[model samples]
Target: MKTPLLQFTDNGIYCKKANVYLDPWKPVDHAIISHGHADHSRYGHKKYITHHRNVPIIQHRLGEINVTGKEWGETFDVNNVKFSLHPAGHILGSSQIRVEYKGEGKTSILFGYSLGKAQRLLKYLNTDIGEIYTHGAIENMTEVLRPLVDFPKTTLITRETKKEQLLGNIVLAPPSAHGSTWIRKMVPYVTASASGWMTFRGARRRRAIDKGFVLSDHCDWGGLLESIEATGADKIICTHGYTDIFSKYLREQGYDARTEATQYGEEETEAALASKSTASV
Candidate 1:
């Protein structure tokens, strides 16, 4: 039972023995994507699986291929491995993957991007399962807060405050084809929510400033700890945030969790180039 070896540059998890690639967007044979974000979706793949709704976007970009789409909770079989797409609550067609190896008799759930607050745009996907119900009562204002629960599942943004305040609910969903619009909107929200622990949600796997969602697409600092407690995954590998803070929080929770921070010296260069190119366009 080994945690998958994830490559930092590509954010691709490759099983050398199985020869399977998870979320490989750079022209791989099989690219199992968590969402339709450009960084997660790519062309020149022999076959792949993604959210059912994202099929339109993927096909529109990648043309023809062996494309398999899955709805939430539906397990699909590929190469003798059974995996199900769970709602990550990042965008319209966002999903977290739950992989079950029938042969190995193992069940593991990976949150491609999970959120605790249910947004208005995607309230239909709210589910009462897990700690969401437990934490729903933390603040009376958050009673209506439902995130990634159930269809059109996406991320939710709450205005944090040191002194209790009623700032109304703010939701952050993917505005355009890519996550640029969402990230743009996230800047303001992050500034607003900086008082408390801010979770930079959608841009987890990508190594760029504008490549993903800027909303709290996953459980926030508190949410992360709580969800980790509920799911009880043997080993927790947290990527995509301030390493020291996440590690400290995880350690205090009495879990065998650790941070995996990947360094990408050239990543910033690529981001700058992309930003410049987009500006020119």
Candidate 2:
């Protein structure tokens, strides 16, 4: 039989054929990082490879590490293993690593922080629908990513924007801003929060928001199903929360699904993004 392409090692997910680790939980010799996040891309690793867009952010956090940048779809071979990077859409530079072993292929989604969700929202938005406003934190990301890629226009939500400007507007904000003082000025506006927690009715009701959008960067049930189907893999592995439940559900659907016991937390989120007034200071 052909050798396995990837396996869960003591340190993290290891690509045996490539001799590299993917988003390793501990320091390793070669780490193919997915994105720049405190937890996912931790400090200390021999060498790193990720998308070109993520290099700056990763460097900012890791500080002078050995890292190589590759544009989307760029491919390279290492020790008989072929690897390529593709946009994962969770954050800027977040990537899905595609590995080929013999004639079979598998992919790992490398997502840590999902500021990229903020990026996707701008792609499909109907600006004609209404004016778009963002909490200062979101606006800052927009400023960083706007020039790198195409995104919709958004105005920062400020004390000066005036209440009248928010009428029938769409505002992207952090979960903490849901009940904060900044939005008191926009009273009577429809309030909605985006989070994976919104999958629970209790989470939504507890927040007291008018609506909750399940706009998490991490894959949901439907998204996982779609991704798995698209991969055309005969078997599936569940790495994180609800793994057993999700795996069972997938098995019931007739696609082979199994849960992999791994120590990975839920994808980190900027759920508590604060306003510019505070972020600036």
Candidate 3:
């Protein structure tokens, strides 16, 4: 058997050719992070690399770490392997890292968390989609990121703002606002949530959401399959999320699929904490 270009280790995803880790949980010499989320971009790494927009985010969280930022699609060499960051459309500075040694492989919107998800929606969404309105919380975070990101014009909701102004406009708010009195102001509005959990049947109904966008920072079932197929790799590794079942299905399909244990949170815990924080706001 050939040595795999990437290996799942106790820490995170390891690339033997580069002698570096991707989103390692434990301390390592060098780590190529995917995003600023605590689980993905942890502290204690000697050196860090991520999207340029994420430089300040991790810095703010980790406090004084040696890190380098890279632009999307800018390939850099590590040992003999090539690596690049591509927009994942997850959060403000979120990215998907692309790794290649020999040759290979290839690689949405509306009311979300103010910090990461809101910025993502703002960056990609446009007036062409709909007139954008934001709660004060979302607006405040967007203001801080204006220097690093290009966002569509978003009117901040205020007492003086007429309900008529919100008509035909998409409003972005924290999840806490979903069933709160604040949202009641938008009478006759349709409620929706963008979350990975939406993949489950009745997720929207459970949350009382009128519509579920099925948008997530993480990959969904279809996304995982599409991504795997695009990689042109016969080997499939599942680190989290129904790993056994997913890998089993992949094997049934004739791919070399397996799972690895990881310390990364599946986002349920993080989502709970975020919910609490936003609920207080």
Number of the top-ranking candidate, with lDDT as the measure: 3
Worst 10 residues of 1 by lDDT: 105-114
Q: Residue-wise lDDT of candidate 2 within 1-281, one digit each (tens)? A: 86577899889999977789999999998998888887779888999998889999999988999999987767777887778787678988898887765532211111113266656766776554356777776777678887799888777766557666666567766555555666655665666556677797687678676666676767777888889889999988988887889889988999788988776655434554442334320
Q: What overall lDDT, based on C-alpha atoms, would model 3 receive against the true structure?
A: 0.78
For residue 70, model 3's alpha carbon misses the true position, in angstroms, by 41
Worst 10 residues of 2 by lDDT: 104-113
How do the predictions measure up, each by TM-score?
Answer: 0.36, 0.43, 0.43
Error of 3 at 177 (Å): 0.1
The parts of candidate 2 lying over 4 Å away from their true place are 1-114, 194-207, 212-239, 247-281
How does model 3 score by TM-score? 0.43
Ranked by TM-score, top first:
2, 3, 1
lDDT of 1 by residue, 35-113 (tens): 8777778777788888899888778876887898878778666665666677787987888876645332211111111
Give the better candidate number (1 or 2) by lDDT.
2
